[model samples]
Target chain A: MLKKPPSVVLASFRPSTYPRGYASALHSLRPCWMVFLNILILIVVCGVSSAVVLAEDHLAVPANLQVFDTPNDGGQSLTVNWAPGALDSPDVRYQVLVGDAGATDVAALKVVAEFPAHTRLVKDAKGAWWTRTAERNWHQFTIRSGKAVELKDGTVYTVTVAMLKGEERIVGPLLQAAPTPNWFNWNLVNNLVLTLIFGGVVFFSIAHARRRDIFLRRIPGLDAVDEAIGRATELGKPILYLTGAHDMSDPSTIAAAVILGRVAKKTAAYETELLVPHRDPITMAVCQEITKQAYLEAGKPDLFKEDSNFFITSDQFSYTAAVDGIMLRKQPAANFFMGSYFAEALLLTETGASTGAIQIAGTDSDHQLPFFVTTCDYTLIGEELYAASAYLSREPVQLGTLRGQDIGKAMILSVIAIGILLATLGVATQAAWPQYFLDFFKDVK
Target chain B: MDATIIGAWVATGLTLFIFSFLYKDNPLFKLAENLYVGVSVGYTIVKTYDTVIVHLIWKPIVENQEWTLLIPVAIGLLMLTRYVPKAAWLSRYAFAFIVGVGAGLAIPRTVSSFILKQIEDTIRPLLMLVPGEGVTFSWNLMNPASSVNVIIVLIGVSSVLFYFFFSVEHSGPGKMVARTGVMFLMIAFGAAFGYTVMARMSLLIGRLTDLIEYSDPSYGRPTLWLTLVTIGTLIVLSRRSRSEPPDSH
Candidate 1:
């Protein structure tokens, strides 16, 4: 049908038969005044509403919703991640909903966490770049064992995300995830790489030392070992040795035990008495074996006493008091304090000093080093304590290990120099590259 | 008297006995020392039983049906095999396992936290650019994170590390570096020694406070009585020692 001319239509806008001017004008514009235009407007409004209803029903909420066990973790954790949607903003509310596996009803799921959509994004996570599970533009929420959630390991759970914009709530697809314990945390790959490098360096050094002489600077404390032993033999006084207050698990304790072997051998050869008092029973047991082996090696098995490496109490001050008693009573000509010591360092060393014994101490405990140095005639500080066994034994393996550690320190020094230079230059030039260099030394997890 | 008051009296007497050792090795000091050793060993045994046996091994196996706890229990039993000389060789298995696992765990963690983290912290930028201003070197000594402190740390770390380098002998320039390292070490040790002296002084203050508290009339003046007894005992012991032959020791 042909539409009416604008002039006729305007002229037809007049008062109707029933009402006042305003209502009559509105009445004339619809119904028959402009039939085709009115019909077209109705169709457009209906179509738009229909399309909106369809979109609300079918369009996915919080795009690309995924659920998986949190990686690089022990277990009992599940992560829900989704791509950032248009609705994400500071004003909009986002929530993490978790339920038993195969649970489809969103109403049944408990909301573990709820916050503004702009927070908890992938970029907010701490650690190295590779530690992030998703790209910067995604939102991540973790469900772990806490007051809000108790996710059991190896049990599947369904997870979903919900977004609230005003009164409208959109729920995402239900996804299943199981919290399984991981054997190795991939986040510490950098740590693994460093350990491997150091291991390779150590092994290579060991091999090289076996082939040729590796020059190790003289450690005076280690050099004094023999002199101390000889002094004990000359005085006819028993040599008193303490392995400190750690178990056999500690590296310092192990070194002390090895040094005990060397000392025991010399003591047996000289037929000078040896007294070793231990705080840990396990260490006492091990040292007994070491002392026995040393005597056997020196062909003085008959002189080796089972009571020599005896267990004292594992108490710090009590053990120190007991050792002090021994020092005063027996009056050992020489005192060897090795391994890690605590506050009792001064108590033992001072007592030994007062007894006029030739005191020699080797320990990595920096806090107690001052006491050892002040009271003892000879003190091995820091790594020197670790190197004492190697220096005394002169064995290829021990020598190589020392050389390897030295090389490792050198490598570390080189890295520090290079990193500082790069970092300084980056700051001056306003470059993004230096952080990558720094990240190499950063602990990933 | 109440148990707390009695405990105070006993503690005061023991403290006085121990203090007698400062004068000379006497019977009182020896008695106190032996008692201290005995009580500490007893405490350790009880603590080990409670923690290892009841909590770690027994509770888990009974409550949670955690059979995995048995493995560690078995290993611990293997460690006890050392008492049997013939079976003593078996204890090496336990030791080996412990050392291997400990080293494996320690190496990675040490590398991560001790080595890597320390290196990262040491290698920081000497300069920083402030917004709307040019690059700047912070000279604020009060701020530990400032560039001046950073430079000091750099020198300290490098010199100390160089000193520990065993392969290179401390000679010529190496000797200079080693000397610088020694200076730094002495400074560090001196500072630590002073700090520890303060700590020890505090400990002494704590002990003195206890002694003073025990000397109150409500506690029956245990500290004063104990001190008199200790002094008398020391004098008698010294007299006896002087009377004895010099070759008796």
Candidate 2:
């Protein structure tokens, strides 16, 4: 058909001239022209840097994923294995990622394991990485799944593996696996040895705890808590307790919690005020529980003022300042420093010493002990803090656990002596006993 | 190189000011201690605002628009209720949540990492002499260690574990085991104690080294000026404090 003249077409366009209206025609035509222009731009842009961006964003999963049992847990965990990505990093590492279902976006990925480049060999398989890949065609990675994760019983759940080059791109063809309960995970071999030792300690201790006269030695540092409290009561002043700066998650802080229980009880019985300044909010909460329990046990629950235990700042130095401020203001007659401490240990102890408070410090932090020893009236050495709960609570479970630890220590000593003998013998006669003896500690590849 | 250097100087001055405590109670030490405390608290407040409030709370709630975070947000708010004495007990609910969650997390991890992992690493075959290997026996190429080292490691790990075991009776075989454990425990303790002593000595040495290093002109004639200024200031302050009545607690 011949095209109409532009002027004629325009002049004919009265409001009612065209039944289907000019607006739709204009709208449709403009978008088509704009889309064409966009296509041209995209083609040019893609042509310029297509290779680089494609290389950066390319992700793939290896074809095969092997699932197996993990050791120690009560039949819950699985170790997953995957082939390494095709373009795996020379310098960086592969992070094993997992999710509940396939087709889930990569953003919701869970990190299963991070394997260093040098230590790529799995404990179960003894072959070299090259040989293993030749035989199985799958590079191995281990994922530990606890009882907490439940993929549908019979349904297939997708597993994806990605290699992260530090904080950069996660490159992979995502692997998918349908996890079934595996009969054996070769990793369990190592776990089996550990379980035996743990059971041995617990078993022997529990058997020993049955005896009537198990002589537990006195820890002078722990024994002085009472004396410290007594002195504070005599001086007509409050007792201050700092449970270190760490949250209750720290073992040292837990030890502090246990010590606090004893101190709280003693303070309650003596009708002396107890002041606990905390650095962590969680620890402050734990201390409150311990204090209440102590007061309740002492039959003075009413005297237990919750506000006496305060949450200071969570910052290390700030917490130190706040506690020091309290000490300078109150001049508490006795200070109990327990749990884990850092640089603040010196600062707090010095302030306490200056105030003439009889400070009893207990912590597993070796670095802080010098300051504690120099300034505090009494200090618990390494592991002494761990012993406090057993001393105070006398719980068989706790006591049993300690006994296990003791047994474990004894076995270690006997070996050390034997090893020393072998070393000396080898030196004296140029024998190979040291080398022979040292072989046992090596990791089974 | 900029504020870090100035900060280092400030830190050095403060450290010396505090160390002056070893000689005698002094005002310069108190001033440094107070400034340290104030600045540290300020730093913490800023960090907590940036991390816990911003990252853990506000980002998740507002930026991510995750409404479920309201529970934690409410609990965090309850923790601040301590400023109000009457409603202070309300904070316990927050405390309970934190403690409960923490315990739940810790027990399983502790059981696995420390207790289970330690035990797993300890036990080994009583005899690791692999037959038909060699005249003297060889280290297992498949495993990390030779047989003898395995036994020694097992012994070390078990004995150490035993020494800390406090619940059982120390009699008969138990006594024998306990005694062996104690000796092992002592040696380990000794080693640890020795290392600790070394570490503390190092720190003392480090502090002294820094003090000496400050004598160099390149870093500035810091030691001389710092010592003289701090001493002079302390002397003045001590005399003033003596003349004035002590601040009552």
Candidate 3:
């Protein structure tokens, strides 16, 4: 119970916070000798330093205490480990106590976790060598903010592992650590490798496209673009076009806008009316500019109606209702539903279908693909929507990017085949080596 | 009638008018559609006003003294310069900044989350290692993660990837794989259609239940009176339509 600043008896017990290596580092100085030497030095150093004394000298102090920041996390966590002491038993409980760094008050540390000895040991942890200890089967525990003192990022915390036998308590030397925000997570290295490979492929493909012709197979949905515009022109009716409900930020919406330029060009050449309704103001503005540019390129700038690409309500069903109203009243000959859609996809496409219009839909949102496929005369599947622009514009850069994406997909397919073969062989042989391949592809930690 | 009953009658009347679209487009349906659009737009404007002007911009600048918010606010205002013909070029700066930042931020996350994660999931192993029973190939059809289902999924995914490969032509073995991919796609769509039909039926049930509740004597039977009023209005409108000349356009 002698708590008069136990720094005299326990100050030497302070293990250096930063360690050169994680094993056999903490010096296990005898408590009796530490007290004798600490007093001998403190008597010469100062009276206040020698004021403290020891309690329960026979209690076994655990050794090799280590506290460090949890690696590869967003921070705010510290891990603690201490070797199993001589008092380690099945019924004996181990309590992990924590406090601010340089805390001298022995009783002030808060116990964050209490568990039976031999439980939560390094041996019981994951079978990775990185997680194991080289010296002893040390008891391990993680300290986070909750049910204990808050461990903030960039703040040092002192952790001590204490063993409890009934009412008897014995604590290890205090170890300090500070949680820090790590800029990069090494856990997602596999994902990074895949991304780098795909990026390199894209760049190489773009460069190669400069010299050679890139072959692109036919997309039936894109092929009907001309036919749909021609039908609207021959019928002397306007073409109703939607640039989807999303803002300009979405890739699907961007693709839709690019395809809109091509459609506007075709309509400008054939002298057909085009109506582009938008749910987002930004997309409306962007599409308006695209339509104008398309018309100017086609030598018919006068035909580009500024009001043709208009903003309806941002609310989904309200936009749907307004579009349905326009469909009924104006009676467009062909309808184009492009970009990402939500529940309103079926509502718009179904109404367009009932009107007997030559409907062609394109969207990357797989959830709405079923409705579009059923309701529209021609439907572009997921990747086909992205490819629609390159198919229409025949631009080298865009075509190269599309071909690169296909190559990436091919790489992925090959991986799946190889992964399956590896996994099958690994299972059949009851070997652990296949885990390296599996872990390399594990997208989630 | 009480205001609650009156509101109920209006709501039921409007709902019925929207339902009248199944018959044909008419003045009643158009009235409901216009009202819906107007109310929705009004609600959205108020919400944006509260969130953007009041909560985000005004309150922070006024109370918290967050002057840095005005930098982005100025950039947003720059987008409005497109209306001024002389200053129209300035709007490109705002558009460029937005598109550039949005694409830069979205590309990596999209690759990691959508592309990489999808590949990881699609390339799963065939056999499972059961702890006590060694390697086991489960044939349980009910378990989606069973070995048989894993092989099926592998085939489905591979064939689909092959079908979408634009660089390669669909011929010989590739054609058969493409056909398989189409079959899988159709099956997925059929299941989705069935699910949607069930969802739509549930929505219908909910509406019908609400109508039944409004038909209670406590609510003064708004559903019954509204239906009669709607039917009477439709009859009168049709009679007038029959007398007048049809729209040429």
In model 1, pairs of residues that clash are none
Give the Cα error of residue A72 in candidate 2, in Å: 14
lDDT of 1 by residue, B151-246 (tens): 999999999999998888999999999999999999999999999999999998999999999999999999888888888878888888889889
CAPRI rating of model 1? medium
Please tell me which model should have the higher DockQ, number 1 or number 2. Answer: 1
- The list of candidate 3 runs beyond 4 A from truth reads A1-180, A429-431, B1-3
- Per-candidate TM equals 0.83, 0.59, 0.81
| Per-residue C-alpha lDDT of model 1 across residues A343-405, encoded as one tens digit per residue | 999999999999999999989888999999899999989889889888888899999999999
Q: Tell me which residue pairs clash in candidate 3.
A: none
Task: Using lDDT, give the best candidate's number.
Answer: 1
Please list the residue runs of candidate 2 whose C-alpha ends up more than 4 Å from where it truly belongs after superposition.
A1-221, A235-238, A292-307, A317-334, A342-361, A364-387, A393-445, B1-9, B81-90, B125-159, B169-183, B193-223, B237-249
Per-residue lDDT for A399 in model 1?
93
Cα-based lDDT at residue A371, candidate 3: 92
Error of 1 at B31 (Å): 1.5
lDDT of 3 by residue, B1-249 (tens): 578888888888888998888777888889999999899889989999999999999999999999999998898898899999899888888888887877876676777677666766776557877899878898888988779898899989988888898878898999999999999988988898888879978988998998999999898888898889888988898899899998896
